[model samples]
Target: MQKNSGKSVLLLFILLIVSTLSAGCTDNSSTSQTIQTSEETSTRTLTDALGRTVEIPESVDYVICSGVGSLRYLTYLEAQDKIIGVERSETTNSASNAKPYSLANPQFSTDYPVFGETRGMDDPEKILSLDPLPEVIIKTYSATGFDPVELQEKTGIPVVIVNTGDLADNKEDLYESLRIIGEVVGKEERAEEVISFFDENIADLKERIADIPEEDKPTCYVGGIGRAGGPQGFQSTEPTYPPFLFTNAINVAYGDMDINVADVSKEKIIEWDPEIIFLDLNTIECGEDRSGLRLLQNDESYRQLQAVQSGNVYGVLPFNQYATNFGSVLADSYFAGKTLYPDKFEDVDLENKTIEIYTFLVCKGDEELGREIYNTMINVYGTPAFAKLDI
Candidate 1:
C-alpha cells in the first residue's frame, strides 16, 4: 500500500510540471503573433507617379502637397480633409484665382496652414515645424530644383511625385497621376470617377464636332493668354489652346513652337487673319498696364482685322491660373463651340452645360455654386470690356 501511494504522488508532480511548461509556451507564441501583427500594420509600399517605389504608412492620415497642382489633384480625390498644409498661392484671394479646386475647397484658405514658397519649393524647416508631422509630401513634376529622393531622405517622410499635364496634349499623364494619388490616399474609387468625368466630357465634345468638315471649321485665335505675369499684349497666345482643340476650330496660332504660350508679332496676326478672336480675360484682370483687351480695343492696327470689324471677337475665361482650371477649359470649349458653330450647338445651353461640368468636377454638384464660379469666370469679374460687342 505504501509503494502504490508513492507512485501516485510522483505521477501527480510530473503532470503539474508539464502543465506549467505548456502555459509558458502559449504565452510566448501569443507575444510573437502580436509583434508580427504590429509590423504588418505599420507600413506599406506604393509606386508614385515618378515610378519610385516608396514605403508609406499603412494608413496615411496627414499630408502636405507641394508644387503647382499637387493640392489640386488631392482636392479632386476628395481627400482635402487629409491635407495639413497648402501652398502660398492657395491662401491669396483674388478674382483671378479661378482654380475650381480652390473655389470648391474654401476651408483650405480659411483654416489650413500655408507652408514654404509657392510652386513647391523645398522648405524642409517649415515642413518639420508642422504640428502633426506630415506622413507624406506630394509634389508635381513641375516643382523644379527639388529632388524627390533627396527630399525624402532629408525629411524622413515619403515623397510622392505627380505630374500635372498641360490638359491639352498630355492628358494620359494626368490620368495616371490621379490613379497614383488615389492609391496613396485610399480613394481609388473617387479617382476613377474623376477620370471618367473628364473622359466623358471630352468624348462628348469630340463626338459632337466630329462630323463637321474641315473646310467648314472656323479659323480662331486666342490672345492675351497669361504666363508668369509679364508684359502680355494682344500678341500673347496659346498655340495649342484647349478650347480651339476640343471644339475642332482652326487655331491659326498653331505652328512648330516649342512652347504653348508665345508672342506673335502684330504683323503675324494680320497675316493669319483668323475669323474669330477669343481674348483671355486674364490680361485685363492684371490691370491696365498688362491689358491685351485694352490694346485690341484702342489700337487702330487691331481694328483692321476682320474679326474685330465684323464683331466676331469674344471673351473667354482665363484657364491658366496657378496651372490649369480644367473646369474652365471645358466650359470655354462649349462656349467656343456655341459661338463658332451656333447651329451645331443650338441644342446646347451654355448656363446649364457650364453648371453640369462644374458640378461634376467641383462643389459637389451644387448648381448654384457652379453658377457662382462660372459667373466669376466669364461675367462678374474677368470679362473684358470689349466683350460687350454685338457679335
Candidate 2:
C-alpha cells in the first residue's frame, strides 16, 4: 500500500509539472501577440472633411497640396517650404491679377515643378517622381478628380482631404481645416493664431457697428463676385457677403437667396438702388468691355444709379481665387466698414490694415513683402483699389 501511494504521488507531481510548463508557454504566446499588435497599429491619425480617419506620421516634413485652396491654407500656416510641387493651374493662370497666395510667395511658380492638372487631377506617378517624395498629400474637393483613397493606393502615400468652408455659413469647417493643416505641418500655434485673428477681428468689426440702428445702416451692394467659370459680370452677388455681414450694411440683395451665392437682375439692382456699391475687382479678369466695371461705366441704367453718379462706388479686393482669399476677405471688411461709417472706422487706416493682414497670413509678418503684394493687388484691381472708383 505504501509503495502504491508513493507512485501515485509521483504521477501527480509529474502532471503538475506539465501543467505549469503549459501555462508558461501560454503566457509567452499572449505576450508575443500583444507585441505584434502594437507594431501593426498606430494611434496617430486625423479626421478630415471627408470624415476619413487618416494615419499620419508623428512629424511630417514633406507634403503635397492637392485641389483648390489646399496650397492657400499651407501658405497661411507658413509651410510652403514643405511643398513637393505645385498644380498646373497655379502656374498657368494668365490673368492680370495673380492669386493672392501665389502673389505673396512668387517662388511657388519658379521653384516647384508642376505636379498635375489643377482642380483635383493629382497624378500619382508625377507625385511619386518628385524629389524627397511627398510623405502626405493634403487635398480639398475630393470629388473633383482622383479619389483620395485611389490616390493613396496608386502612389502608396497617404492622402488627407480638407474643406474650404466659406465665411458665412460653414466657418467652423474652415477652422477645422486650418487645424488639420496646422497639425500636419506642425504649425498648430499658427493655426490658432489665424483663427483667433479672424474671431477677434470679426468681433471688433461687429462691435463697432453694434450700437447703430439697422435702419440707419447704409444700403449697400457687392457685385462682380468670381465664380467657378471666372468673372460673372455685375449679376454675380452675395447676399450674405462677409464684409456686409461684418459691418451690418443693409445688403440690397439680402433676405431670400442662395445660402452661398445669388444673382440679381439689372432691373432689380436699379430698384434697390443701394446708397453704396462695392465692386469686387475680380471682374477685371473679363476685360474692360465685358467686366462688371465696364458694365457700370457703359450702361446708362447703372450710370443713372445714385451711388455711381454720386461717386460713392469703390473697388474691393477679390476674396476668392483658388479658395477664399482669407486675408482679402478681412481686408475688404475694413474697407467696407470705413466706407459706410467713416466716423466709426475713422481710426482704422485701410491700406495699413490690408498690409497687416497680408503680412501675418502670407508674408509671415514681413511688412515689406505684405506691402509688395498690396501694390500688386492695386495695380491689377484699378481705381487704385480700397478707395473711391473714379466712375
Candidate 3:
C-alpha cells in the first residue's frame, strides 16, 4: 500500500504539468482575439451636416479643413491646434484682412501645411503626404470644389461635412454646425457657449432699439459689399444685410430688390437718398477707378446724395470676406447699432466692444490678443474700416 501511494503522487504531478500547458495555449488564442476586437472597436459613426452617416475614429486628435470658413470654425472653437493643414488661399498675402480668423492666427498661414486651393478644392495627394497623417477632413461649403464623399474615398480619411449657415435667417443652422464641429473636436461646451453668446448679443441688440418709434427709424443703405469674386462697387448691396437686421435700421434696399443681393441703380440711390449710408470697408480694395470709397468721394452722382452731404456716411467692416466673416459680422452690428441710435448705445464703447467680440469669438477670451487683432485689422483696411467716413 505504501509503494502504491508514492506512484499515485508522481502521476498526480505529471497530470498537473499537462493541464498548465493546455491553459497556456488557450491564453495565446484569447490574446489575439482581444487585439482583433480592439481594432474593430476603434471607430464610431457620425452624422454630418449633409445628413450623411460617416464612420470616424473613436479618438480623433488631428484633422484638415477642406472648405471655405472651415478653418474659421476651428478658430471659433479655439481648436485650430488640431488642424494638421489648411487651404492655400488662407496663406496668401493678398487681402490680409479679408478673413479675421486668418489674421487672428497668423500661424495658420505659416506653420501648418497647405492642403489645397481655396473653396474645398482638396488635393488628396497633398493630404495623404502630411506628417502624422490627419484622421478626418471637415468641410463647410460644398457647392464648389471637391465633393466631400469623393475626397474621403480618394484620401482614405473620414470626411465630415458641416454648414456655416447664413448669419441672418439660417442662423440656427449655423449654430447646429458649430455644435457638430464642437462634438467632433471635443469642444461641445465651447460651441454651446458661442451659440449662447450670439443669441445674447442678438437679443441685446434688438432690445436696445425695440422701444424706438418706427417713424423715428432712419432709412439706411449698405454698399460696396464683398462677394464670391472680390469687392463690388458702391451700387452693390445686400437687402438682408445682417447688420441692418441686427440694428433694426431700415435698409432702403431690403424690399426693393428681387434678389437677396445685387447692384442697385445709381438713379435709385438718388431717389431713396437714405438718411444713413453704410459702406463696407472692403470697397477700398476695388482699386482707384472702381473703389466704392472712390465713387462715394469722387463720383458726382454719389456725392450729391443727402447722406453724403450731411456726413451721414459711415464705414463698417466687411462681413462677406470669404463667405461671411462671422466675427466681423457681430462687430459690424455693434458699430451700426451705436452709429444709428447713439442715444440707445451711448454707453457702448466701440473699441471695447470690438475687443470683446473678437476675444470671445477668435481669441478665446484673451483681451490683449483681441485688442491686437483689432489694431491689425484697422491698420490693414485703414481707420475708416469701422468709423465715420471722411466723406
The estimated TM-scores of all candidates read 0.87, 0.87, 0.91
Name the regions of candidate 2 deviating beyond 4 angstroms: 1-43, 93-97, 258-262
Q: What is the lDDT of candidate 1?
A: 0.80
lDDT of 3 at 97: 41
Shift of residue 14 alpha carbon in model 3, Å: 12
lDDT of 2 by residue, 1-391 (tens): 9999999999999999999999999999999999888865643788877888889877788998999889999998999999979888777644533777898777787889888887888888899899999878999998897888989999988898888897778899899999999988899999999899899889989999999987789889999988777776887898878999988989988884533464678888898898999998888778878688889889999999999989988998886686678888999999899888889999998889888888988998899999998888866654567877767
Q: Residue-wise lDDT of candidate 3 within 1-391, one digit each (tens)?
A: 9999999999999999999999998998999999999987799887888899988888889988888778888889989999888898878876634577877788887898898988888898999999979988899886679977788889889888898797798997798889888888889999999888888988989999999889989999999988888888888899889988988999998877454466888888888999999988788888889888888889998888889999988888876877788777888898899888989999998888888888999887888989997887765676457777887
Which of the numbered candidates is closest to the native, going by highest TM-score?
Answer: 3
**Which segments of candidate 3 are over 4 A away from where they belong?**
1-33
Each prediction's number of clashing residue pairs: 0, 0, 0
Arranged by lDDT, best first = 2, 3, 1
Candidate 3: lDDT of 95?
A: 63
Error of 1 at 276 (Å): 0.3
Give the whole-model CA lDDT for all candidates, comma-separated. 0.80, 0.86, 0.85
Checking candidate 3 for backbone clashes, the offending pairs are none
CA lDDT, candidate 3, residue 51: 90
